[model samples]
Target: MKLSEGVEAAIHCAALLAGLAPGKTLPAAALADYHGVSASYLVKHLNRLVAAGMLASVPGPHGGYRLGRPATRISLLDIVLAVEGPEPAFRCGEIRQRGPGALEPEAYRKPCGINVAMLRAEQAWRGALRAARLADVIAGYEAEADPRALAFGCAFLERHQRPGSPLSNPE
Candidate 1:
């Protein structure tokens, strides 16, 4: 199934947040710049993440955004849901009940086989996403990404990470 572009941006933003020092945060504009997306577009997704409790939005001059919880606790499914909502990619309209030679309403009481299969596949896909934590993604990135890519990410975080107060709650 095709997911929205926002999902990619949201996942990348989460991974970047995982790299920040404890209590550090990054502004939306900086995140957009790093991801090569518009700040307005990124903010919409960021707001959704905050609403989903996947991200924490801090206020004030030294404030920005940070993880709502540990990276280990946040799954890719969480990010996907935050950006794309919880609806499955496929929806069955029960076309079997429509058109010519359609059976009586009670005759087609059994769920559509095609719908059942699609839902089953969607469940499997969601299960895989649910099993994948943001921490795992970051670990894999650090381990498998190109050296220059790693260096650039590190440099960007070093340069743009805002210093949130030690006592401030990320939420």
Candidate 2:
């Protein structure tokens, strides 16, 4: 099923935050720059994450964002829900109730077969996402990513990650 771009951004942001040193955070603009997205567009999704307790926001200069909880405790499903919401991907319109042979409400007492099947599929999909922890995503990337690409990300983090202490933040 197709999910919104916000899901991708939220997941990526969480993954990137997974790499942050404790007491460090990344500004929304810096995150947008890393992913080649508009800062404004990315902030809304980031705000959703913050609201969901998946990401924590720190205000003021030298304040940005970091994971609200450990990567090990945050699932891909958490990020997906934070951005895409809890609605099922396939919302059955119950077209079976609309056709020529449509039966009375009492006659069609059972759940629609198509709706049941779609609901089962959605449950499976959500279960899979729930099984995927953000820490595991980081481990997989670190283990399998190209060294050159990894180096670029490492360098970018070094450049943009803001330390929590004002003394550590560059003017």
Candidate 3:
């Protein structure tokens, strides 16, 4: 199934945050800039993440966004759900019972084979995503990333990160 652009953005954004120093935060604009997405549009998805309890918004001049919990506790499915909601990607409209060659009402009582297969596919997809946490994504990224590039990214984040923010100092 094709996921929305927002789901991609949210996953990337969460991965970025997962790589940050504990309690450090990145503004939505910075995240958008890093990913080459529209900041305004990305903010809508960011808000969804916040509402999902996956991320927290810090309010103030130095305020931005930070993970609400450990990256290991936040799965790819969490990010997907935050941006796409809990609806299954493949919706069954019961078209088998609506066409000119409609099946009998008794047939409608049971889900069609196509619908069952789609549902199983969706379940498998969700299971895969649920097994993948943001930390796992970041770990894979770090494993394959160039040392110089990783250093450069760390430097860039440090340079852009806000100082003295409460988020930067966990209680």
Evaluate all candidate structures by whole-model CA lDDT and list the values in order: 0.90, 0.88, 0.83
Between candidates 1 and 3, the TM-score winner = 1
For this target, which candidate reaches the highest TM-score against the unseen true structure? 1
Error of 3 at 145 (Å): 1.2
Q: List the residue pairs that clash in candidate 2.
A: none
TM-score of each: 0.95, 0.93, 0.91
Clashing pairs in 1: none
Summarize candidate 3's per-residue lDDT along 1-171 as a digit string, tens digits: 788999999988877776667656788888888889999999999999999988888876777887777788999999998899899888888777787998678867766889889989999999999999888889998999999988977886887665425533332
- Where in model 2 is the C-alpha error above 4 Å? 165-171
- State the lDDT of candidate 1 residue by residue for 66-169, as single tens digits: 88888989999999998999888999988888999798899998889999999999999899999999999999989999999999999999999888866654
Q: Is candidate 2 or candidate 3 better by lDDT?
A: 2
The residue pairs in collision within model 3 are none
TM-score of 1: 0.95
How far out, in Å, is residue 67 in model 1? 0.8
Estimate the overall C-alpha local distance difference test score of candidate 2.
Answer: 0.88
* Model 3 lDDT at residue 95: 75
Better of 1 and 3 by lDDT: 1
